[model samples]
Target: MIPHAALQTAADRFGTPLYVYDASELDAALGRVRSAFGGAQVYYAMKANPNLTLLRRMHAAGVGFECVSGGEIARAEEVGASGDRVLVNGPAKLPGEYAAGARLGATFVVDREEEVGLLPPGSRALVRVNPALAVSTHDHLATGAAGSKFGVTPAQAPGVLRALRDAGHTALGLHVHIGSAIRDAADFSAAFARLAELHPAVSDLDVLDVGGGWGVGADLPGIAREARAAASVFGAELWVEPGRYLVAQAGTLLTRVVGQKRTGRPFLLTDAGMTELLRPMLYGAEHPVTALWEGEPAGTWDVAGPACESGDLLARDVLLPAPVPGGLLAIGEAGAYGASMSSTYLTRPRPAEALWEGGEWRPIRRRETPQDVWAMEQGLE
Candidate 1:
């Protein structure tokens, strides 16, 4: 657990609507993953939280990265994570993106038949298969289900692999990501079981890339055990790319209460809004919101952000102390998608990011100024 004092200090120095990541917490999560999956390749999906501070630390710890876009790949490379330490996995990679991966000697998780054209001849790659497995997660997050736009179907794998071979690429593995925020061990275990069943048919199946979708407080031990057993059966190299699991619990979003209202139920508005953290509005994500001081539950309050939309609520019917303006509140479990998915919607400037390392707060991503936000549109009018 992060010292609340550290969070207070960060807000005191940086200001509200700030993100503070605990480096020690992140390291501990990575350590646990390493110990659990011995000899298996663990890739940090940089999409969750691409802060350079965190990326550099993971690189130093010898953790590989899985990039969904060219930008993420660049972020990983910027932190000195190179070939074999990086894998590019995107269905719609840009023209030179695969070339960039090739230059970095990064493995590609080919999602489409045409994407194979981007890789050079004889380069080893993994083909992502869509098993149409209906995972017990949000419909929007279930990627492996049929009709999703993520990967090729199992039926198409042989053809895709043949195309890759025809184009002189080596199909070394098969990958599957049923969905995100999946808590049931059975979902992961089943996905692995399905892949294990498909292994013998794949002539060059030397690796299995079971994508990560573990939720907070998920069944990790059971999932690991299942993964090990499945890997043992195929004797294939195991790879799990987890983004949220490693960082979600390590961050807190500090926002200051700017306004308070009472209409039967309490309404507390903060400077942070959907533009800063869209998970609530975007995915109905729930994070425990707590006031800085300890207090008894006053009543169920509506916590909303400063966004113009009525949907910009951080949470609803949440128990908190009496609504008070000019007070501070920290949203927990915000270490993953909070900052990474942030946008300058409504022209709001992006928040500053800080990392708590060695018991001190250090600025990682500086807050954007109005000029910084308008720089791109300068001279247009």
Candidate 2:
């Protein structure tokens, strides 16, 4: 674990509503993936945390990138990820985005048949097959099962492959992303078996992309083991696009206590809230939070942000060391989807981002200012 003293210094210098990432922690996570997979290609799903600094660091470490939109593709390219090393996947692709990926020579474009023709000729493509297997996770995240909007059904794969083959599009891979935050190895193993069943029909295949949705929590080792074992079964040029598992535990959201209140339950109002981190309010997600300073014994407090909605609570009835006004609190497991999903809701400016390396903190992204928000609006004549 990184020392709290360094984090305190980072918060003090960069100010609250800041995101601090430990470079060493990220390296350790990548090293773990490299060691476990043994020559398999790993792609960092850019949608998880596309902070340019993080993306560039991943590229520098020899990791590939996975893009879901044209903007993400441009971001990856701006950060030095060449098109040949980028994989584009999304159920819906706008004409402009498709053209951008094709123009960039993206390594693999995972298609769901709805817009396969949108891709330019000679584009290497992969068919996203929906296993239709129900994996236990939040409904908003469960995409592999039947009726999901993510991929084509299993029965539709062979036909899609035949069409692509006849159309002369290079069908070189098969891709499937079951869901996010999965906890069981059996889920991945089963999904792989389902994909392996279709491998024989698709010819000239050189890659298999098991879309990254590996879950991370306190039980990371078990999850890694399961993911690796499942990947071994493919026995092809395997690729895993892991986002959450890579950086989720390497970050924290430091919020300052703004006030304390009691309603049906005690509420600890913090300077940081849904506007800064929305997982809890959006998906009922739970993040382990603790006081920054060592102090009085723990007590149950409903952590909430300044949003007007009643659902803006971060964690309810969570135990934390006694907090006072201006006390800092750290929200754990925030490295992946935390800041990437922040918004300017309630007209609040976005937070800045910093990277911790070599025993020092450096500002990677500057904090947003009020003018930055309205810069896009046309001024009155």
Q: Who wins the lDDT comparison?
A: 1
Per-residue alpha-carbon lDDT of model 2 for 54-140, expressed as tens digits?
988898988988898888989977987776578887877777777778777886555566555667787788788788888978888
Candidate 2 residues lying further than 4 Å off, grouped into runs, are 217-235
Segments in model 1 whose C-alpha atoms lie over 4 Å from true places: none
Q: Residue 287 of candidate 1: its Cα lDDT? A: 88
C-alpha local distance difference test of each model: 0.85, 0.80
* Candidate 1 lDDT by residue in tens digits, 142-219: 888887899887878878888887888877778888888889888887777776776666746678788888888787
User: What shift in Å separates residue 365 of candidate 1 from its native position after superposition?
Assistant: 1.4
